[model samples]
Target: MANAFERLVEKMDRATLDRMGKPVLINDVGFVAVESHLIPEMGPLTGDGISLVIFSSDYKPRRNDQTVWDGQSYIVTRYQSFNGKPQVWLE
Candidate 1:
């Protein structure tokens, strides 16, 4: 059944995320432990933005929040659900 297969895929994705996710800080306050995937091909979705999809089981950063990834500071410009997970667009 398609539903059963979807559930199985979800479980597998969760397991992968649990094993690969790492803790990241937001504005030095909110902490989210998620597996972040970078989208460098978009060439700044917000005209000087960095697009990243974050898979987390607990928290997600809000819009206008700040984070430092790979030693570079970024500003969160957008937050939306992608494939049932959080996708963050930063500038």
Candidate 2:
């Protein structure tokens, strides 16, 4: 069972994605909604990758999974849960 806060988070996640997500193909199989952004710089390394936020209920990402967004390909480098959502790092 989910608590009230968790239920609220789920609602907000769905609403946010519905309003702002872009289509992304996962492993060339099907499309899922994701909020994609440029990877942020860490230390002295410049950013040259993509970060994707997607609903966990929609898709569970794994390392090395291929994704295509805006006609460009990317490989998942990392995946973790953020605020009950899935945050994916791609290169």
What tens digits encode model 2's per-residue C-alpha lDDT throughout 60-82?
78899998877888899988886
**Ten residues in sequence with the least summed lDDT for candidate 1:** 29-38
lDDT of candidate 1 over 1-91, digit per residue (tens): 5698898988877786678655555677544345445565945533445556665546565888887665678888878887777777766
Worst 10 residues of 2 by lDDT: 36-45
Model 2 local distance difference test score: 0.75
lDDT, candidate 2, residue 35? Answer: 61
RMSD of 1: 4.4
Best by TM-score: 2
Tell me the whole-model lDDT of each prediction, alpha carbons only. Answer: 0.66, 0.75
Q: What RMSD value applies to candidate 2? A: 2.9
Which portions of model 1 show Cα errors greater than 4 Å? 1-3, 11-23, 29-48
